[model samples]
Target: MIAEPHLPAELATLLPPSLHALCVTRRHDQGDRLFATGARPAHMFFISEGEVVLERASPHGAATVLQRARRGFVGEASLQAARYHCDARVLAASRITRVPVIAMRTALASDAAFAMRWVAMLNAEVRRLRLQCERLTLHRVQDRVLHLLDTEGERGRYPVPAGLKSLAGELGVTHEALYRALAALEKTGRLERQEGALLRVAL
Candidate 1:
């Protein structure tokens, strides 16, 4: 048995034993490219620590963050695709486990339990993406910011250890707009920005 400490706790327990030998763990620094758009999918990445974002660039050269993964898998949809649709970039210094895509697909075909868990994980991500879509439709930055705190926070506190710039991308807003919204909210006592988190003030 591979020691639990060797892999992320989530993967150590979730990945089937047959695929264990094929997993490799590595440390990635911020700004490192894990994979690029149009590249063949080679590995499924599990974020053991820190963060990564799936990003795409438009023809005009503007970049958009499609997904931000702090834990669990990034680019789950890549499992079925011939090539990656977006670039996976390390958003922070991170520890990651890479599982060979071929081995993972084989395990899914042969192991019913692991396959079911993978489906459930994808379902949860779908729900988060839905919420993100709804947030993007709101016109006000404060409204979107509040919605994030309401949905994703624990006990009305959302940690921003990665800082507001990262949170801005997640909220689908520019950092300048996010800063303005937060400032207005703080002045109105609508929220409090602590050392590393945002706390929604009780009504």
Candidate 2:
């Protein structure tokens, strides 16, 4: 028999051990729709590998990516929601662990330490959202790009193992626009595109 995939250590440590036994892990292909807007929340999904995105479409048909989760929970707000407010789709081939909503709720209600850890996790997500909001408010695409590197990237370098185009959706810009901005930055010697990453060049 094949062994079940376990939760990522960062998340596994936060959830109660009892909940770990209830997790169901599976592999998903890119473009798989995990859940749709208006669907009743059945489970909380944790991305163990690859990317999953939460998105919502406007009346004009433009989709806004609310979250691009590579190694963390997706749509965590759905735990208390009656229905999903946005669609959850796999942005890249992924391994995911699903915890039944009811089981998760019960664990939180019964496990104070686990609940506190969960709250702290959510707070960190909130800060990321705030940073994203700030990035979106910047008028220049290059400014947004630099802001992402400065904040989300490690040591001023952002991994682009999937290439920079993969970031267009999260950055709320067309791939063409992002490419142009990156090229302009490269011309000015402010950015360096290396294999699998973009580095900020110090003046």
Among these predictions, the greatest TM-score belongs to 1
Candidate 1 per-residue lDDT over residues 113-153, each given as its tens digit: 99998888888878988998999999999999999899877
Summed over model 1, clashes come to 0
Q: Write down the lDDT that model 2 would get.
A: 0.84
lDDT digits (tens) for residues 50-94 of candidate 2? 688888998999987777887678867788999999999886768
Question: Where's the lowest-lDDT run of ten residues in candidate 1?
Answer: 1-10
- Give stretches of model 1 more than 4 Å off: 1-5, 188-190, 201-203
Residue 131, model 2: Cα distance from true site in angstroms:
0.9
> How much is the lDDT of residue 168 in candidate 1?
90
Candidate 2 Cα misplacement greater than 4 A, ranges: 1-4, 57-64, 160-163, 194-196, 201-203
TM-score to true structure, per model? 0.84, 0.83
